[model samples]
Target chain A: MTASVPAIINEFLTGSFSTIINVLKVLIPLMILIEFLSVYHVMEKLSKKLTFVTKVLGFSPSAVLPLLVTVVMGVTYGAGTLMEMNEKEPLEKKDFILIAIFFFICHGIIETTAIWGTVGANVIIISAGRLMLAGAITMAAARLPFFKP
Target chain B: MDPVVQIIKTGFIKAIKTTLMLMKVVLPIYALVVIIKYSPVMPFLERAFEPAMRIFNLPGDAVVPLITGLFTDEYGAIAAASQFDFTAAELTTVAMIGLVCHSLPVEYALSRKIGLPAGKIVIYRILAAVVVGLIISRLGGVLL
Candidate 1:
C-alpha cells in the first residue's frame, strides 16, 4: 500500500486507540497496586531500608519513598508523590536534581518490560544499565559543591 | 469503612485521571507520527539522523523510533520500530536508548511542575542516553 491519505488517517485513529488500550492494561493494575502498597505503608517501610543509599545520593531521608516509588512505578506517579513530599517538607534544588537524575534513568521496571519484552530485548541490560547510569549520575551530582545547599 | 477499600477507590479514580492525561499526549503524538510516516519528508529525516544513529550501529530508518521515542513514549517507538526489520542486538540498542530518553514533553513538564530545572533535566537525559548507548555498543560489540 502506498499509504494513501485515508489509510494514514485510519492508521492514526486506530493506532491511538489501540496504544491507549495497551498502555491502560499495564498502567491501571499497576496504579491500583501502588495505591495498595502506599495504604499499607509498604513503600515507606522500603524507603526506610533505602535510607543509606538516599543519604549517599545526597537526598534527604524523606526522598526515599518517592525514589522507591519512581523506581518501581514511573516518573508520573513518582513525581506526584514527590510533589506531595515537597509540599510537606520542601526539598532543596539539589535534592530535586538527584531524585530526577536517579528516576530519569531507572523508572518503570514493569512498564519497560512490557514495552521492550515483545522485541526480545535484553531486560537485564536495559534495567541494570539504567540503574548503573542513574547511580553514577547521582553519585557525581552528590560530589558537586552546589549539592550541599 | 475499611481504610484499605477507601484507598482502592481513590487509586481507581487516580488511575483513570492519569490514563486520560497520558492519552492526551500519546494520541496526538501517535497521529503526528502517522502523518509523518506517510509524508515525503521521511527520507529526509532518515538522512538527517543517519550520522547520529551511526553511533548505535542502527540503520538510518532506525531514527524513526529514536525520534518517536524521544518525543512520545515507548509504545510509539515500538510501533515505529515494528515496521522495520532489525536484528535482536539492534533492537536492544534501540530499546535501551528509548528507555533513556522517551516521553520528553510530558515528563520534562512534570519535572518542572515539581520545581526542578526542566531544561537541564532534559539535556541530562538525552546526553545520558547517547553516552550510555555508545558505551553499550562498544562493550557488546555484537550490537556494532
Candidate 2:
C-alpha cells in the first residue's frame, strides 16, 4: 500500500504539471503584453474617449479610468483601482453599481481574446460586444424605475 | 547595450513576471476542471445544469463550462465558448451573460471579506447577466 502511494502521487503531479503548462502557453504571453501596456500608461489616451462614451451611460468621467483599465487588464486590477479611489473619496452608490456592472459584463481582455481566438472566434468582436452590452445595460438600468443605483 | 535593446529586455522581464502571476491564478482552475472532467461526480451536476442551460439557449455540454466559470472565472466560459461554432452575436451574448453571473463562488468569497452578502450578490449578478444576455441577443438579432 505504501509503495502504491508514490505511483499515485507521481501520476497526480504529472497530470497537474502538464495541465499547468498547457494553460500557461497562452496565458503567459498575454499577461506579459497586457502588463507592459498597463505599466506604460498606453491606454490613457483612449480613456478620454471612453470618458465621453460613459457619460451617455450615466457614469461620471472619473469612472472611465477604472472601467477602461479593467477592460484592458482584468477585473481584479480594476477593482484594486476602485478600492484606491474609494480610499481617496467614497464613490456614490450609483457610480459603484455602474462600475461593478460594467466589470461584471467584461474584463481580462487578453485571456478572453486568446481563449476565443483558439476556437476561431473573432477576438475583436467578443471584446467590443461586451463593452457595448455593458454600456447598453447600464443605460437601460438607469432608465428603469426599480433600479436604484 | 543600445537604448532599444535595454527597453526590450526590461519589457520582456516585466512581461514574464506578469505572465507568471496570471498563471498562478489561472492554472489551478484549469487543473480542477481536468479533475472534474475525469471524475464521476460531475455528471450529476451536469444534469442539474440542463434546465439552466436551456434558459440561456446554451447546449447541455455548456453546463460544465458555465459551472466552471462560476467557480473559476470567465476564462473557462471562453474556453467552452470557443469549442462551439457560435456566431459573433451568440458568443457575445453568452459572454455577456457569463460575465455577469459567473465566478459566483470565488467572487462571493471575496465579497464576504468586504462584508457583502454573498448570496444576494450572486442573485443580483445572475439576474443582471441573464437580463442583459437575453436583451442583447434580441437586440443583436434585430439590429445586426
Candidate 3:
C-alpha cells in the first residue's frame, strides 16, 4: 500500500506539472502580444471601426476594443483588458454586462478557426456567425427593462 | 524613420507581441491535454462527459472536447476536435454551438461576480446552447 501511494502521488505530480507547463507555453506568448498591441495603440484604430457595430448592439463605442479583443484573444485576456481600462476610466455596470455577454459568447478566434478549418469548415462563416449571434444577444439583453442599470 | 514607416514598424511589433502572448497560453494548454491523454485519468473524464455528448448527438469520445471547452476554454475543444473525423457541416455546427455555450466555469464565475444568480446563469446558458446547437446543426446542413 505504501508503494502504491508513492506511485499515485508521483503520477499526480507529473500530470499537474505538465498541465501547468503547457498552459504557460500558450499564455506567455499571448501576453507579450497583448502588451505590444496595447503599447502600440493598434487596438485604437480597430475599436473606431468597430464602434458602429457595437453601438447598434446597445454598447458604448468604447466597448469595441474589449469586445474585439475578447473574440480575437480569449476570455481572461479580454477581461484583463477591461479591468485595465476600468482602472483608467470606470464603465457603467450596464456596459460591463454588455462586454461580458459579448465575450462569453465568443473568444479565442485562432483556435476555433483552426479547429473548424481542419475539419473542412469555412472559418469565415463560423467567425461571422459567432460575432452576429453574440452581438444580437447582447443587444437584446441590454434592451430588457429589468437589465437596466 | 518617416511617419508612415514609424507607424508600420510600431504596428508590426505590436502584432507580433500580441501573437506571442497568445501562443504562450495556447501551447501549454495543448501540452496539458497531451499529458492527460497519456495518463490514466482520461478514461474517467471520458466517462464523465458521455451524458453531455448525448444531448448534442455526439459519441462518448466527443464528450471530452465539449466538457473541456465548457470548463477550461475552447482551445481544449479545438484540440478534442482535432481527434475527430468530422465533416464540414459537423465542424461548423459544433463550433457554432460551442461558441454559444462554451466556457461555463468562467462565465458562471463572472456572473456571480456581477451579482447574478449562479443557477440562473448556468440554466440560461445551457438552454441557449441547446437551442443554438440544434439550429446551427440544421443550418450547417443547409449551407454545406
Candidate 4:
C-alpha cells in the first residue's frame, strides 16, 4: 500500500534489515557468554593468568584487572574499569597512557571478531593480527623513555 | 532466581540494548548507501576517493564504509559496506581497520578520563588503523 516510497528505499530497508538480523544472531549469544563469564568470575581467573604477562611487560600489578576487562570487553567498558581503578588504586601517568594506547588498538576481541565474522572475514586471522599488533605496539610504547621513565 | 536464568536475562537485556544502539547507526547509513548507489553523487565521490582507496586494494566506494567506520561505529561501516561487491582481501582489510579504529567520538571522550589528550588518541588510532590496513591488505591474498 505504501507504493509512494521509492524502490531504492525498499532495497535499502531490506538490505540493512537483513544485516540487522545477521547481527542479532551473533550479538545474542555473545552477550549471553559475556554475562555468563562475568557472573562466574571468569574474568578474575583470566586476570590472574595475565598477571605474569603484565609483569614481564613492566606494567604495574594494579593494571591487570582493568586490562583484562577492557581487552575482552570494548573501549567503553574498559574505560569504566580504568575510571574505577583510577579512583581506587590510581596507576601512574605512564601506566595509564600505555594502557590507553594498547586498548585503543585492541579491545572487544570476541564481540567484534564475531561481528566481522558475520560478514565472512577470517575470524582466526583477524583476532591473531589484532593481538599481535596490540602486543607489539604496547611493548614498543613501554620501552620508550616517555612511558618507561 | 537461578544463576543461569539471571545470566540469560541480563545477557538478553544487554543484547537488546546493543541491537538498538547498532540500529541507530546502521539503519540511516545503510539507507544512505542505497540512496548513494542510485544517486548522481556516487560517481563523483567514488572518483574522488579512488586513488586513496587503491592503496588498500579497495574500490572508491569502499571509502564510504571506511569513513563511516572511523567516524561513527563499525555497525554502520559494515552496513554501508554491504552495498558493494568487495573482494575477500578488500573486506578483510576493511575489517582489520574497523576493528582497530571505530567510535572515535565516544571512545576518545571516554579515554580522556585517563588524562591522555583525546586528539592524540584519535590521531594515533587512525595511524594504527592505517598501519594495520596496509599490512592486512598486502597479506590478504594468503592470509584469507
Candidate 5:
C-alpha cells in the first residue's frame, strides 16, 4: 500500500511537530539552566577551572571561553567567540585544531540531550564516549608533525 | 528588578530562540523524509545505504537519520529516527553518531569562518563519528 501525497504531508507535519514538542521538553529547561548559569557567572568560574586542562591540551588559557561556550551553546557560539579572539590576538594553529576536535565531538549539551535522551540512548555512552574519543583524537593529532606549535 | 525574574526572563528568551533555530532544520528534514517515504526513491537509496549501516547493526531505515544528521542537525536525525522501530542499542548507535557529527555544512562553515581548513575539519569529524559508531555498536554491552 502506497501513501498518498496528502498522507505524507500529514505525517510530516505531525511527525515534525511531535518531535519539536519532545525535543523542547528537554531542551527548554536546559537552555534555561544554561542561561541562568551564564547570568550568574557560573560559566566564568567553570572556564577558569578548565584552564589547567587547556594548558595541558597545549592551548593558552584564552581558549577557555570558546571551549566552555561551545560545550554549552554549540559550535556557532564558540566559533563566534574564537573569531573575536582571533581578531584581538590570534590563537596557534595547533590549538585551533585541538579545540575544533573537542567541540566537534562534544558540543551543545541541549542538542545531545534532546537528540539522544529522547530516543532512549544511554546517557553514559553518549557523554563519556564522545569525551573519551575527543581526548584520544586530540592527543593523537597533537603528535602529528603538522600540529607542532 | 529581582534576580529571579531576570534569570527566568533570560532563560525563557534563550529557550525560545534555540527552539526556533532547531525548528529551522528539523521541520524541513521532517517534510523531506515524509515526502521521500511516499516516493519511489527510498527503496533504491535504502538498498544502497544499507550495507554501510549494517556495520553499526542498524536497519536500512537508519540511513535516513544518519544522513539527515550529517547534513542538517541531530534534531532532524531524531525526527527521522522516530519514524522507525529500532532497539535501544541501535538507537544508541544512531544517537552516538549524531552526537559526534551533526550539522556538518553549518559547522564546517563555522570552522572556516574561524580560519580552520573546512575540508580537513569535515573529514576528521565524519571519520571520528564513523569510528566511534562502529566501536559503540560492537562493544556496547561489554564496555557501556
Candidate 6:
C-alpha cells in the first residue's frame, strides 16, 4: 500500500517540524550543561571515574561524555557534544572509528528498548545483545593490527 | 558578564549552530524518504525479500516491516510489524535489526557531519543487523 501524493507531503512537513522541535528541546539544555561541565571541569572529574570505559574503548577521557550521550540520547544529540569536544581536542582516528562502531550498534538504548518492546520483543535480550555485541567488537577493534590508537 | 551567563550564552549559540547543521542535512533526506516510502519501490522490495526472510526465521511477509524499518523509522516499522502475528523470537529479530539500522539515509548523512567513518559503520551495521536477526530467531524459546 502506497501513500497518496498529498499524504506524503503532509507527513514530511509535520514529521520534520516535530523532529526539529524534539532536537532543540533536548540539545539546548544538554549543550548548556556540557558548557557548564567543561567550565567547572566536571566532565574531567567524571571521566576519571570511567577509566575502565576509556581503557576498554581505547578512547581518551574526553570521549566519555559524547559516547555516553550517544548511548542514551541518540546520534544527532551525541554529535553535538562530540563535535565540540573534538574541536577542543581532536580524538584519534581509531578512537573515533571505535566510537562510531559502538554508537551505530547500540545508541538510543532506553528509547529503542521501549519502542521495540511494544512489538513483543524481549527488551532485555535486545539491549544486552547490542551492548555486548558493540562492546566486544569495539574492544577487539582496539587491538586490530591496522588501527593503532 | 557573570560566569554562569557566559556559559549559557556560549552553549546556546553552539547548540543553535549544530542544530542548524543537522537540520540542513536531515530535512532533505526526510523528504526523499517520504517520497520513496510512497513509491512503487516498496512493493518491489517486499517481493524481493520474501524468500530471503526465511533465513531469519521470519515469515515471508515480514519483509514489509523489515524494509519499512530500514527505509523509514522504527515507529513505522512497528506499525507494519503489528499487522502480523509475530512471536517473541520473530519480534526480537526484527526489532534488533530495526534498532541497528532504522532511518539510514538521514542518520548516514548526520554521521558524515561528525567526521565519522560513516560508510564503514553503516556497512557493518547492516551486516550486524542481519546477523543479530538470525541469532535471535534461533533463541525463540527463551524470549518472552
Give me the candidate number with maximum lDDT.
4
- The true-versus-predicted C-alpha distance at residue B136 of model 2, in Å, is 7.5
Writing each residue's lDDT as its tens digit, candidate 2 over B1-144 gives: 765455556656765675566456555555555455545655766687767766655555566655666766665565444333566656656665666667777777755653345576677777777776667656555554
TM-score (0 to 1) for chain A, all models?
0.76, 0.74, 0.68, 0.89, 0.83, 0.67
Worst 10 residues of 2 chain A by lDDT: A1-10
Mark the regions of model 4 whose C-alpha exceeds 4 Å error after superposition. A1-5
- TM per candidate comes to 0.81, 0.69, 0.66, 0.94, 0.90, 0.69
- Where is model 5 more than 4 Å wrong at Cα? A4-10, B141-144
Give the per-residue lDDT of model 5 (tens digit) for B41-110. 8887789988988888877888988888888877878888887788778888889888788888888777
Cα lDDT tens digits, model 1, B1-144, are: 888778778877876887788777667667766767667787888899889888888778788888889887887787666656787777778888889898899788887788888898788888888898888766555533
How do the residues B1-144 of candidate 3 rate in per-residue lDDT, one tens digit apiece? Answer: 665555556655655565455455445555555556556776786688767665655555565556667776665566555544667777776777776677777778866754445666677667767777776766776788
**Model 3, chain B: what is the TM-score?**
0.65
TM-score of chain A of 1: 0.76
The candidates, ranked best first by DockQ, are 5, 4, 1, 6, 2, 3
Write model 4 residue lDDT over A15-100, tens digit each, in one string.
98899998898889989988988789887888887788786666877787777788887667777778877788888887787787
Candidate 5 lDDT over A1-149, as tens digits, reads 28876777788888888888887787767767776776777867888888888756666787778888987777666777788888898887777777887888888865676567776777777877777787777767766787655
- In model 6, which residue pairs have backbone atoms overlapping below 3 Å? none
The stretch of ten residues in a row with the least summed lDDT in candidate 3 chain B is: B18-27
DockQ, candidate 5, comes to 0.71
Per-residue error at A136 for model 2, in Å?
Answer: 1.2
For residue A102, model 3's alpha carbon misses the true position, in angstroms, by 1.5
Query: How big is the positional error of residue B36 in model 1, measured in Å on the Cα after superposition?
Result: 3.5
* Clash count (model 5, backbone only): 0
Tens digit per residue, CA lDDT, model 6, B21-68: 767655765675566556777567657876798888887667766777
lDDT value for candidate 2? 0.64
